[model samples]
Target chain A: MSYNKRNDGRAFDELRPMDAKVGIIKNALGSAMFRIGKTVALAAVYGPSELFPKFLQKKEEGLLRCTYNMMAFSGSGTRVKPGPSRRSREIELVTRNALESVLDLSECPRAVINVNIELIQTDAGTRCAGICAASMALADAGFKMKDLVAAVSAGLVGDKIVLDLDYSEESFEEGAVDIPMAFMPRTGKIALLQLDGEITKEQLREAIKLAKKGCKQICEVQRQALKEKYKTEE
Target chain B: MGILIEDKQIVVPGEEVAEGMDFLPAPGTFRDGDKIVACQLGLVNISGRLIKVIPLEGAYMPKRGDVVIGKINDLTYSNWFVDIGYAYEAALSMKEATTEFIERGAELTDYYTYDDVIVAKITNVTKSKSIDLSMIGPGLRKLQGGRLLEISAQKVPRVVGKQGSMISMIKEITNCQIIVGQNGRVWISGTEIWQERLASEAVLLIARKAHTHGLTDRVKAFLESGSKK
Candidate 1:
């Protein structure tokens, strides 16, 4: 069976509407909130301060640690567990790797920069929203970064390639393939690429192309959110 | 072939600041191929052929010769550990703790017990991130009775103004003795409680508006009106 139309009525190449804002958490070194469709991610950055448990400290560069969590009632299906789970741990590691590529931490040797992302609501693209929010929070904290990382999921709901799969599309009765990807828009570097289901080589390539185009737009929103925090009064 | 951003305009990481080799990349920016890209979220500052970004916020990196306010966190027989708002705790040895000689094994708490706030100077910062502090310099002493206010470390220079004009103006008007630490810790003492409160409010106002133009005049007017109010 062929999937001709998106569940949410969005075009094949269009993403869910996104909203982002920075400097939301005053006490944090830097903070941001990103919402794509029904998923909401709040990210806060702290440190480049001391790294404890001395063994983990790197003398050459600072460490980037990320923690991803979903609130108890954030999931569209059922209640999420309150604490860390295996899925959350894996997401945390991937999120850290996604952001570490653009950060320059040599000046902060033996220190650690922590990015905490909490999903206030989830509709399918929780990790992608978290990464986008974390990237803005890092820049808002004034960290030296080579570039911002923008992420979104592009995949096949049945046989049709689509950008930013929503919950309905993710759980489509027909087979669905979700590929969450992150990119450095300026350099066109892929920071993250994870596929959940199988797809033909040609379909995978087209999905990646769509994801990159979506990432470029997400980067623009991230830049605007950072600039908005420091907008001068007229 | 030219700078892409106007001076004083804010730019974010990876944003192109200049497109040609005519501009030299400075700190907070780096050369990416033929382009000078900003690696920080900061205001672009162009001087002659040099292009740099002045960061608006970040954690304070301790530097030698910087006077900072710290609270005593721990004490050994000969050394006191001071929290100078940095990642590493600074060591203030008995020899550098005061002008008067401190005998070995002397009761350290008598001089500076835990949580005693002191204004000290950074003597040395090692590559491993260890910091050495000295309390013998002028204006370096344990704060007696005052309120402490913390602002962003990056705004300390603005609070001090050019050649101490801004702080001096504040001190004269508020009738308060104000000491701003490079680590963003501030100590303000006044004969009247209201005077101390007013001085703190002014400092905070300056910190909030540090990026804006005409801050000195605004601060002056704020101090005058604040005094009257």
Candidate 2:
């Protein structure tokens, strides 16, 4: 497939300009808007109230639910499906699991917390953007959590590794694979792990190493976003 | 595997994998040993034979065995439905509500009523994502006669951090019986009128300044100043 190179001419592993805003949704309990290059996502948090049952309910803990949606105009060329699809479901599960790892569910008994991640733009790393957006929204919602979570995607393209893969580089055929991950930088724990593409066993080691390095950089962005969010309130 | 790339696992520079463990191919996305770079800056986990990475910021979700506060939205003959911010509303049955004589027929509305917030326990959840709640426990009561403030579900923890440290502080200082609804609505009441107002202000300040570290001291200062005023 044909591809257009990014303007800044960053190395393969370099991320794009990123910014995030929290507590922006008035209706939601907690809300956030996050951007990584041109890709963007907005997340909202709700609940810790009554749980609807058919499944076993934990009387002593809260439930976690995530919904991930991509906007009609989020993509560059073609519009995405307006409603929920199989891909959206999978993304929701991934986002939910990642945030659940950091949240303190035992604090709120017999309640449910709902998170909604809306993709405003579809760059290469929408899933990673969704993770970051949802985390900020969760914090905006005031849910009890152990730590914050930051996510970003990295991949191997040609002889060089790239950070925060964009749309063109993601689908281009310079021999690349995408790795999306979430972690608690303080405790240094893994929350979500997903990969797509082709790398040998030895290459996998190097890829993971690069991914961790990328995650630390992403954490700084998250902190900046958080600071900006709270600063506005002040 | 050694034909070209040797180890077959690609480890990025500055990345940390577990000790003594060799990196394996990333499930669906690896070609023998094509290099993969770090996406976000985070920590690597090598548990058993699996290698995964995690990010560092997000919200908290409710789990089993959590103590939460909620608001009453609707009531039926069999149950009271709550808006817990999930896909479906949660149910609180008549059986688990209370042992005291709750009038059987039409008078039930007068008892619980709509929009009355309460504190309850999550007794069960269904596979389809339904949650069942109970009010028959210690510290669970109908929350009424107070000012209610809504906060972010994620910020709930930071506001009530580390084993109720923040909450108790607010309660003790303001001398208010504060009821925090798991769904983000909080109820505050005090023996004196101004005390409730002070508590409410303190809660709002905490909610606004949650992202900053060491909020306890700030909250304390705000409370002292507000009480004086």
Model 2 error, position A94 (Å): 1.9
Candidate 1 residue pairs that clash: none
TM-score of each: 0.97, 0.58
lDDT of model 2 at residue A214? 75
Best by lDDT: 1
Tell me, per candidate, how large a share of the native contacts it keeps: 0.68, 0.08
Tens-place lDDT per residue, model 1, A1-234, is 788988778899998999999989999989999999999999999987888899999988788999999998898575378999999999998999999999888777888889999999999999999999999999988889999999999999988999999988988888899999999998999999999988999999999999999999999999988888778442
**Which model scores highest in TM-score?**
1
In model 2, the Cα lDDT at residue B136 comes to: 84
TM-score for chain A as predicted in candidate 1: 0.97
For the predicted complex of model 1, DockQ is 0.71
Q: Candidate 1: where are CA atoms >4 Å away?
A: A232-234
Question: RMSD in angstroms, all models?
Answer: 1.3, 11.1
Write model 2 residue lDDT over B1-229, tens digit each, in one string. Answer: 1122222222221232333324442321122223322222222334444444332222334344555677678887888887655545678888888877766575666657788777887888654446788888889888768777877554676677689999999898889988776556678889998999889888888777665657899998888887787
